[model samples]
Target: MRIGVIGGGAIGLLLASLLKQTGYSPVLYVRTEAQKNEINEKGILYLPGEITSYVYAEHIKDLSQMDIYFICVKQHDICSVNSRLSGLSGTVIYLQNGMGHVDMLHNMTEEQTIVLGTCEHGAKKRDQRTVIHTGKGKINLALYNGNAALLTRYKEVLNDKRFPVEQVADWGIMLIDKLMINIVINPITALFQVKNGELLTNTHLHKLAKVVCSEACAVLEVNEQQQWKRITYIIEQTKENDSSMKEDIALGRQSEVEGILGYVLKKTSHQSSVIHFLYLSIKALEEKRG
Candidate 1:
């Protein structure tokens, strides 16, 4: 299968590398000509093991003519590539962080298969051609709309020992679970500039995280206890890693706060004080940093 991975960020690089390792010559579509040239020349440098996988690289405009595509861009950038994606006839799996991009998928043609994916692995882009894999986690996939058989087939084809893939029955549930984790971890860690582990280690932060978790569960109408358990388990699993929002704040880049907490705010009938506070805090930090 000819796989195309859009966006040459951390997740993009990691997915391209995994595809190469899984015996498929995947095309990695990057944002710039310079990055494409660099990656084509030096290949993707995967860290921890220092493995290099030489995959094909092309410009994002040339994203058509692939059997499958993994859209690894952020929520804010989804609109920029939606037009290009609409032209393709293959399966397009979106691996964005939050639920903001879900509405856009409704525009896809019935001929094309759309899949929603949530990545649990912790990855950091060191440079144009290098990515550091901080933690290993499964790629949870749920069929948003389209062929269920194709989804199941790719679930097996993409599942490797190093990079596992699991299919969920409900796309909404899968995304909500990930959103809850981001709601508690992303904002708090960015606010305090702490790692994932600190949310549990720091008693004060832990308390704040619990309160935020409760608010999120209330807004989403999910079981707070179950969500809290899942959140803490992920925190422990990726403890050494920095949340993506924190990285964005530190680098003066825009975070996915709107897709995350902002989405929660839109869903609630009444105002959630804690969620509102975090939402404003993240936006304030973005303005100050940007």
Candidate 2:
């Protein structure tokens, strides 16, 4: 299968490398001429052993013919490429962080098959052509619209021992399940400037996370205890790692607070003061940084 990965960042490179490892032809859509040239020359170099393999890289303006295109960019960056994506007709799997991109998907061309994916994999980009696999994780997938049989085909192509993939019938549940995790962890860690483990070790922050999770559950109508366990498990699994939200704040880049919290706020009529305050706090940080 010919698979193309958009957004040559951490997840993009990781996906490209994994696909190549599994004997699939994966092309990467790079942002810069330099990155495209580098990968086309030296291939994508991934760690911990500096494993290198070749893959094709093209400018976003230059579209390639492929069976699938993985949108591995952050939610906030999706709009920049949405128009380009509309022109392509193929299976476009979006691996965004939250439910925010769900609405944006509605605007895409109907000729394309839209697949929603929630990735738990932990990865960091060391450079333009290198991505470090921080922790092994699963890729939970669902078909929001289009051909349902595509899920079976994708499962066969994407599933591997290193990065297992699963397809669920309920797309809404799959999205909310992942959103609940993001709601609890991303805001607290970014605001306090702590690692994932700190949320569990610090009593005050731990309780605060519980409050936030409770508020989200109240609004979303989900099981609180089950969601809390998922939060803590993810924290323990990626304890030492800094969250993507915190990284965005540190780098002076925009975070996905809007997608994580804003989406829930928009969906529900119930007022969640805690989530509202945190959402405002993140926006304030963005303004201050600006």
The TM-scores of all predictions, comma-separated, are 0.97, 0.95
User: What digit string (tens of lDDT, one per residue) describes model 2 on residues 178-225?
Assistant: 999899989899999999899999999999999999999988999999
Model 2 regions lying over 4 Å from their true place: 269-272
Evaluate residue 123 in candidate 1 and report its C-alpha lDDT on the 0 to 100 scale.
Answer: 96
Worst 10 residues of 1 by lDDT: 266-275
Query: How many residue pairs collide in each prediction?
Result: 0, 0
Model 1: CA > 4 A from native: none
Which pairs of residues collide in model 2?
A: none
**Which residue window of length 10 is worst by lDDT in model 2?**
81-90
